[model samples]
Target: MSAPQYLVILGMLVNVSFALAAHGTARTGRNNARDNLVAVAALAACLWWGGFFG
Candidate 1:
């Protein structure tokens, strides 16, 4: 696969990881979930743009 595809996949994983982490933390009443969600969103945005940015 090309670099763009790799980036997309990596970014996607990062996004998913953060999402899962946030979900887990939610049960503890922690407030970091929002931050993780934001980071995940940013990663996903990068992944989406990487496909056409190159």
Candidate 2:
């Protein structure tokens, strides 16, 4: 894969990691709006990056 593709893949991995972390926290009954927001932002960023650079 090219550099941009690698970056997009990395961004996707990061988004997934964030989602897993958020899920774990939620399972613990933690009110982590910030984490959820960050995960959403990461997903949006991944989408934008993929659209622009993929």
Candidate 3:
């Protein structure tokens, strides 16, 4: 209900969305090293920001 909780929720949503997108890409054979790197970066960002804000 507060800002930190909101940040945590938002981070979770972002991570889930990224995971789904990465999975879809892999299924379609369109996934590449760069895509994987980007996904990893996004996940790291989500964790860092979420922890910091929370």
- Which candidate comes out best when scored by lDDT? 1
Q: Write the per-residue lDDT of candidate 1 for residues 3-45, one digit (tens) a residue.
A: 8767766876776676666664545576465677677678668
Candidate 3 lDDT trough over 10 residues, lowest sum: 24-33
Query: What's the ranking of the predictions by lDDT, best on top?
Result: 1, 2, 3
Candidate 2 wrongly placed segments (more than 4 Å): 24-54
Residue pair clashes in candidate 3: none
Q: What is the C-alpha lDDT of each candidate?
A: 0.67, 0.66, 0.64
Give per-model TM-scores: 0.45, 0.44, 0.44
Residue range 1-54, candidate 2, lDDT tens digits: 478767766776676666667654556476565675676677768766768644
Clashing pairs in 2: none
> How much RMSD separates candidate 1 from the native structure?
4.5
lDDT of 3 by residue, 1-54 (tens): 578767766776676666666654555466454555576577668867777534
